[model samples]
Target: MTTRRSTLKLLAAGSLPAMLAMPAARAQQPLLRQLAIVVAFPAGGATDAVARLVADGLRGKYAETVIVENRVGGGGRIGAVHVKNAPADGSVMLFGPAFPMAIFPHIYKTLPYDPLTDFVPVATTSKGAFALSVGPAVPASVRSMADFVAWTKANPDKATFGAPPGGGQHFAGALFAKQAGIPLQMVPYKGGAPSVVDVLGGHIASVVTPLPEVLQHVKDGKLRMLATTTERRSPFTPEVPTMKELGWDVVFQDWSGFLAPARTPADVVARANAAIKEAVASPKVAAALQAQGTDVDINSPADFARLHRQTWERYRDVVRSTGFKAED
Candidate 1:
């Protein structure tokens, strides 16, 4: 009994710093007023592209400079860790995607940072859905998910699916395979662009991807859309059937959102959040997002936090059910 009490006291003592620092940390904002927005993935990707757009839109909205820095490495873990460890002054923020923010914790055994404990949600800039698209060489009549599944089974070794490794697109393919009761040979590519190349060049049967990456191909008849992963139909592509509409009961969406280091001051977070909301609400920004087939969903901090939680929970369940490994 005495030893137990002593150990408890020692543990309490060790946590003193966190307890004591809370008050001081909340007292005042840090000196650096400028905001550094970190993008985990390489330039030209969806997250990077959206971060640049938000930065550009905030030009006259805030008094301080809002600079976007691309910290590309380790499938977005590097940049996410950088933001997690950055000073919680609200000056350093990160634009996180599905990988680091939602999918990493489930797959990685020991992550350098914690998504819930290390970051505070600010706002969700945009949300988009995924689609299964077949290249021009594939039969144009392959319009339904079941039809595609049948074709894959008929030509088991011959059919190929291209997707970016460890991305939501890859997960989409995996989930589709699991649900449709078919086996697909996923061919991992460097990025979505390369994956699209393989699909368009007749190298792969189909590619699962966010609408922005393959919207043109579908419209131009270079690719055929089988189904969308959106809960409902996408506003841009109402003609495309969703997995849910087809009675599959699967819904997945890709989102780009802003997150600051945990414990950033309320005022700072509010300021950043307000700027983001304004940026997304702008006509030009809204138009740009629509152009990419992404919905301009600028949610409040609390609502965005809820969405973040839901995303993580859904993917975590997938990891657990599939016994996914963290080898990457």
Candidate 2:
């Protein structure tokens, strides 16, 4: 018994040297190269703003150069494809909305790439609620959800609304139509800014879009908000009600985040995710997002991935329930 005990202790003592050397091996490797943040939307949009904020945060923590490149087109598919095909190194990251990750594939007939197979979800940085607003030409009495639904039902084809192509805004309108059991002719714009312009110009009856993009028009009375898309009213527009609270069936928001190519190194993903968490926690960045009526959500890479899968699954069901056929 004594000999066996001595032998076991000796064996245990010999393994300590190897365990100590393991950390040194990791330390010897070079730090990650400069990061390239790819934004699918055009510069000056919410996605661009969020990406720049994250990049600035990463710059504060890491010595590597961080560059944000806007690759706007095809409703994020183009930039998404660009990142998916790029080197799987930690250097290339995509900053955009959940559409590219979750909703796009279910909608389009032929997507350029497979979201699940091509990219890895890093984090869901922020989300902003959608607002139901009317142009200056509309009646102010149409402020409540009840009033808005009644008006749309009575007007029918007269209720022309504009939304970005194949986005949360479009789905918001569809859900609203489905709940109210009324038809709303939705006009498709390439982006939110154009739709905001059309609504403010009285070219459309109303516009359902992210609050940050259309808040200014609402403040200036060019547009009047009827309700928000969530179950709760936004603090930015506290007076506005919600579709669910009003007994409707629409819950939609514009959410943005980061994703890297699949098979990125664990160390690199960890480093990138750490930088992202720090960025979203920064007071300056939080304030900026809050000012735009966005809620910052900085989660670990694993949590973000879980949320990514959950959101995609939910929306996939929503898309399938809508019976929206694949567009050619």
Candidate 3:
């Protein structure tokens, strides 16, 4: 009896090792069957373009199939809410601008999703600065922000600037007008593309929009970039000066990145981060984004989270100072 008991004990002890190894082995398998990259804006926009590029890069990187979905409306809030309520299994991710994540919380009376608690920053895929551009209605001699301000003051009737409604670009124009001590009228467009269209048609004197949307027009001589919204000159437009350099306190840059629902498993987040970093670093992806005047900025999950927090606080103050409130 004693010998039999000893053998049974040894067998049970040996089985414990196999049981421990089972979970680790299963973890090596794919975490998801499919991956969805959700774009909060309409398709064919810059954000959607970047999301598709990353999706293409991640196609064969993992066993799961990748797809991009457009979840439009509410200035990106609708899509953000959908992702925030999604399963924490890393199957769903948000590829969107900074507004829904950082700026909306302060501007809106009640936001559906809490950016600080509802999502995890996976990686920042690209960054682009805004440009204060003047269309053909403005004289070619009005080349800089200083010159633009002087011209607006001289001709208040034609001092109108266009920007997307309730976006960073709107506030940038407002702040610029306030700082320059000019009564500049800001016309709100539904999106950047339409604003650019109006500016090209000479219906609007100037516009504050994403550099990429206006860069080609500037190159084509249809629009003139007075200054960029970055602290330094953009590499794509090295000749253009920054607003700070031109004695205006306006400096803003827009970023697009990936975010998963909060509480996703650490391993899944790590895998997604790796895939995004690789995608952002791919030559084809870099070239496509650069052609759009966007610079690649891949970061670790933790670093990206830190950046999100810092940017949130900075924009909170900005929104507060503007005293701008979105209608509930």
Candidate 4:
């Protein structure tokens, strides 16, 4: 029938545009050629270590070449800015801790990049906690946080803690000092390694830094962990107690993840997210990060972005409450 033929032609015409647009839509999708996971700190540090692990995991998973580039400076701002200014094509990404994204914006008077707008979180690689360690300056008998606080009170002149200047560790030390009702002086170091070194050499009474940086020293008997800034005991150090258990309400944990520039196609972000989740889920990658005291935390891009926003707000409140400001 003529009417039936016309209806069929109209149906075929309605389907033709979508069928023809499929190839063009696919053509517009970005193809990843090379990938770079930028680290804000120098190589050999924990951030770099994780970045390299991710780079290895993503090497054959997405782009042809996945390399880690250290753009170290400005306490991670330099590297973050580098990634922010990069093209939003999924070729360049930042692989580092959440400090620059969540904490620094609240502390710094002027930040080069807006964490909420400049980047899209791809995946969360790991979560880690900081350790409150006492060096040779504290007596071996002083084991717990209460004992350390008593010792500091008894030795006011030697009551000083060291942490990297303008970092979460420094703020954690400040918060601990405030909550413990101790008059402790904060000695700033350039990095965790140096701070740990000072604590080992008795230059400072204690050091508040990530557990991974001081875990080996604790094992070697060079340093003693008094408490961790974690809600619960870290699996890496089950014997250690949390600050909360000691009746101090101090709890801080840092998360590291991958972030691509904003405006990158949603599919590209999803692709990167999938590759990252797969890479982090790999046994070898998880084991490598675990060996560094980092627990793998794979999450969806939406969840990661929400986490970033939540963390930023939390840090903002902390900075406001502490009246902390970074020296330019």
For each candidate, what is the lDDT?
0.80, 0.79, 0.84, 0.85
Candidate 2 residue lDDT tens string, 1-328: 4477766775778964665588999765564558889998777666777788888888746426889998977878888989998888878889887876788878988988887778887777887778878986567777666777788888786787787667777788887777677778789876677787888887888887778877777787778888888767888888878888888778876468888898987777877787788888889988988887788877778887877788788888878766777675
Stretches of candidate 1 exceeding 4 Å from the true structure:
1-34, 63-65, 326-328
Rank the models by TM-score, top first.
3, 4, 2, 1
lDDT of 3 by residue, 255-290 (tens): 778999999988888888998888889899899899
In model 4, what lDDT does residue 215 have? 85
- TM-score of candidate 4 to 2 decimals: 0.86
All candidates: CA RMSD (Å): 11.3, 5.1, 4.2, 4.6
Q: Mind giving the per-residue lDDT tens digits that candidate 1 earns over 176-258? A: 78777787878986557677887889988999877878888888888888889998888889998998887775677867799
lDDT of 4: 0.85
Candidate 2 off by > 4 Å: 1-33
Report the poorest 10 consecutive residues by lDDT, candidate 4: 26-35
Quote the positional error of residue 300 for candidate 3 in Å: 1.2
Q: What residue pairs clash in candidate 1, if any at all? A: none
Full candidate order by lDDT, most accurate first: 4, 3, 1, 2
